[model samples]
Target chain A: MLSPAYLAVAAALLLALGPALPAFAGRPIIAGKPAPSEAAATARWLTAQNTWGFLSTISSDLSGAPFGNVVSYSDGVPGESHGIPYFYLTTLDPTARDALEDQRTSFTLSEFPLGTCGKIDPENPTCAKLTLTGKLKLVDLQSSEADLAKSALFTKHPEMKDWPKNHHFQILKLEIENIFLIDWFGGPKPISPTEYLEYGKNQALLKLS
Target chain B: MLSPAYLAVAAALLLALGPALPAFAGRPIIAGKPAPSEAAATARWLTAQNTWGFLSTISSDLSGAPFGNVVSYSDGVPGESHGIPYFYLTTLDPTARDALEDQRTSFTLSEFPLGTCGKIDPENPTCAKLTLTGKLKLVDLQSSEADLAKSALFTKHPEMKDWPKNHHFQILKLEIENIFLIDWFGGPKPISPTEYLEYGKNQALLKLS
Candidate 1:
């Protein structure tokens, strides 16, 4: 009983919504497919834009075990309010990554133009990404600790109290000695150190400012 | 001593490289300090583009526990292939993902932008993407017990190989009703029927030919 126009409208509507978007409700439409290079660049830009990264590490047991955790972090010393970075993390006695878990650990942080779950952009709702690879080292929050990570943290992220104290609060000073940013779709080139720093700064500003 | 020209070149180099990336090597730059959305997207794109995607499923034991496995996929029709979507997996073998041994599983696939690995382009890497998620299913290979799945897989990846006989090849098919796609920074969004077709098509042809 419906006209062809109706079907066309429906199809057009579907096309406009983009892939896997919520507009279709439960149905997901596959949105922008980045050509390898484009996708990779998009990923680099994402890593540059977003300041927070995930921490994937091998457990203490040395069983080749991988443990992934959502963590909050910063770029500068947690002192002298200037150039400080931090986040509100809710945890309870997370010693391994808690208030006092500064040990040698490897972490990977990445993201791409294609959006994904866990950290969907509330504003854009349709992009997907993930961290390529990086490393994370827990910064000692205690002033006496060797790492200068304490005061700078509380100043920027004042909302720390709002987070449940069940988990010890602390900061992870990022030590990205080497990261292989993969954008197989983009240009399939590794992110240069200079490029990475430039991108990281912008991302930090987004987080702090 | 550092010369003025050296400093100027350093500044120029920094500017050329952008500030996000650092100049010093073996230095860990803080990234994803707050787990921004972009980084998440990069990570997601990597998952989708690297390995072919597969659907994962779980079986319950007598007491109702869950067990699962991630089956490699090669997508496309069996004989005349357009893309490889199925995986070299094991079938009818509960031992691979039986509840007694396993409880959780992950589904992975690569999204090629244009060149290298799963990149779709040769010049840009920011756009590279990979989709990673858990939960998948199995599909009939459309072949005899002695079958090859090279033709079908993650949107027609050129790097994948055909089905392996003795290696226990099982196709990772998704429950169309429960299918979802997430970007690196973008969290899980359901894939609609419309997106399914478009992405399926894109998987076959890099561009809309």
Candidate 2:
């Protein structure tokens, strides 16, 4: 019942798929099906990779409201299972000092071109490349077994030998509360919170796996 | 003659090298006896991967300077050398549309965290992050060839299918002039007009790879 022209067009469309898909086209394979509580899986994936990430500290003074600096980061292994992307960092850096003075800060990581290449509207909450907001808490160093864990930290980055060592850098850890994770492609499902945590034993969410 | 205590201490220190260094440090490994050109090498390496960096476009009309947003990007490819990063973007978003009209636009691409992140201080060139004056251009979707090169743009983003499609994204690109890359930890080399085109061309600049 279809016209001859329609038949010809269908044939052409079929032929184009093979050459077009792989050559001048691109695709990323993401199995987006996550369990009900597997919210932090994406954060886990991001932390698992050796991606460049930053540790931001809120400046204490009102003059320095929300300033952040780039710093190397590591994932919180056990805490991640709880859905909070906790990072290991020191309070010695100015940014960290500022954050300690005021714990509010932005910790960001991005999977970029893939995110921006598409239509991104800043007004649209979903449009940001990488956005996270939370309070940065300085955790204890020697409170736990610092000796054994210290070796692990050094093993990962041997350059610390040259740095002027400090218990702040050597002791305190960082934890991100009320976190936000934005993955451009294959990111986790978006969840908009009506209100930030009112403060509790664990004020964080989206733990790294 | 040196004291016996000094000699013993030096011997013990030499033996401790194996356990002294921390594992997750940023100091680059200097394979040779001399510290290589750490600044230039670090700058080059940092500029290399920081392509998706944020381009902070500022604008003001009747009211005053509006808040800013970071634009995701990709610069020069690995094989065919180019100093300026190549960014593919579109005008569908209001920010880009508004940015197109503003001439005083500038960008700051935060390189992967330097233990101390460099921030932008436009007036002070000495500051690690400074105004790298550049211009923005819109794409002409008619050029199918260029569009083909960035075709994979959407394959990775299936959520994008929900948004309307426009061809202009295929044509637009950015050309940055008088730009300098900065690194706080790495010894930063001076950026010259010629070096922008000459040195960075061969390096695999963007994080795309």
Candidate with top TM-score is 2
Candidate 1 per-residue lDDT over residues A1-209, each given as its tens digit:
33345544654676576544323122122333332333333444444334343444433322222233333344333322222223333233121432223233333333322243223221111233333332344445554532434434433333332333433444554444433333221212455445545543433333322
- The candidates' DockQ values read 0.02, 0.09
Worst 10 residues of 2 chain A by lDDT: A192-201
lDDT of 2 by residue, B100-184 (tens): 7753333444532332223322111122342243555654556663554344233323233333243244233445554434433
What shift in Å separates residue B98 of candidate 1 from its native position after superposition? 23
Superposed by TM-score, candidate 1 places the C-alpha of residue B33 at a distance from the truth, in angstroms, of 29
Candidate 2 structure quality by residue, lDDT tens digits, A16-57:
675432221222223331222233444444443423344444
The C-alpha local distance difference test score for the whole of candidate 2 amounts to 0.39
lDDT of 1 at B48: 32
Identify the leading candidate in terms of DockQ. Answer: 2
iRMS values in order, in angstroms?
15.3, 9.5
Residue A174 alpha-carbon offset, candidate 1, angstroms: 2.0
Model 1 CA lDDT for position A137: 49
